[model samples]
Target: MSLANHLEELQRKHGDIERQIDIALSHPSIDDLEIVDLKRRKLAIKDEIEKLKASPTTH
Candidate 1:
């Protein structure tokens, strides 16, 4: 897939992960480690998206 499409998919996945984290926190038990891992993944995806946007596009 193109960079734009990849970014969109990343954003969508990030949103889904965020919601999952929210729900996990609301429960009687919360996994801080899991949340941390998810946050790290989200940040990585954002970084990749930024890099893709910055680089020159090729046809």
Candidate 2:
């Protein structure tokens, strides 16, 4: 797939993670470790998106 398509997929995953985080937070029995892992994954995806955006060919 092209860089643009890859970026879009990553963004969609990131949004899905955000939704999961929200749902987890809404639960009274949510595990803190799980939430932290989810947040870390989300940040990683965001960082990747930024790196892709910064690539010369992406422009």
- Top-scoring candidate (TM-score): 2
What is each predicted model's overall lDDT from 0 to 1? 0.79, 0.97
Please, what are the lDDT tens digits per residue for candidate 1 over residues 37-56?
87888788778767877888
> What is the alpha-carbon lDDT of model 1 when measured against the actual structure?
0.79
TM-score of each: 0.77, 0.97
User: Which stretches in model 2 have alpha-carbon errors above 4 Å?
Assistant: none
User: How far out, in Å, is residue 30 in model 2?
Assistant: 1.0
At residue 52, what lDDT does model 1 achieve?
77
The alpha-carbon RMSD values of the candidates against the true structure, listed in the order shown, are: 2.2, 0.5
Which regions of candidate 1 fall more than 4 Å away from where they truly are? none
